[model samples]
Target: MKKLIYLLFFSFLTSCSSFSEYSKETKKGFDEEDRTMVSNEAANLKTITFGDFKFATSQKEFRKLNKQKPQFKEILFYAKTTDVPYEYYVLHNPKEVIKNESFTYKDTIIGNSRFVIAVSKNAPRQDSEFIKKMVLSLR
Candidate 1:
């Protein structure tokens, strides 16, 4: 009886230790991925100040803003509209040097300037006012 109890206790301790190690490794992997995403976004972004908030702004300012990190070759600057469900985007080249389509506005050729564009889609409406303000600021 004594040996059986001791074996059960040892097994429990070993399982607990293994689970703890697995949890730590999973968390470390997630942290590394987040860092990599941030680094990639920074490398591709030509300008951080798309809307009212800048990526380099203070942490408090970032908390009050509504923007997403650069992803899928597009940087979303603001929230999507409810009526149309559209979000503003600033497209960028994925590669180091690649000639792409020039940014345009109302059929006018805006050259290769990286400008804001409204894309139709289902997105959260968190920063509508800020997006409008930014567009107005551009005009």
Candidate 2:
């Protein structure tokens, strides 16, 4: 009976430790992917500013827009309707970027409910250039 109890306790302890190790590995995998995505996107940045927000896009896309109208009509509409300032509309692809839990930031929904604007006051310390641009615009 004593040996059976010891075996059960040992099994339980090992399971708990394994679970924690698994969780850590999973988190590390996510962080690595987030870093890669941010690096790639930031390298491709072609940006335009409206209010306090900086909009990022590929140079190819930026050239297609009518310079006068700026086709940010949806964005403009949301900006006018919401109490939030234009600068809050910083990130281009908010959904993907928001997955990085390491970066601390705030967000507001805008643009016909299709867009989210990410705001961060602290200078970005992480490798995400997109977040760096967002923080810089706050200054």
Top candidate when judged by lDDT against the true structure: 1
TM-score of each: 0.22, 0.21
lDDT of 1 by residue, 1-139 (tens): 9999999999885443101111111111112223211112322222111222223122222234435432223232322233443444433222222222321221111233333433332423334333323221111
lDDT of 1 at 57: 25
Q: What tens digits encode model 2's per-residue C-alpha lDDT throughout 1-139?
A: 9999999999886443101111111111113233312111221222222233222233222234323222221221111112232222233333244333322444443332223333323323342235334322211
Report backbone clashes per prediction.
0, 2
Lowest-lDDT window of 10 residues in candidate 2?
18-27
Per-model CA lDDT versus the true structure:
0.29, 0.28
Query: Which prediction has the highest TM-score against the true structure?
Result: 1
lDDT of 1: 0.29
Task: Tell me how candidate 2 scores on lDDT.
Answer: 0.28
How displaced is residue 5 in candidate 2, in Å?
61
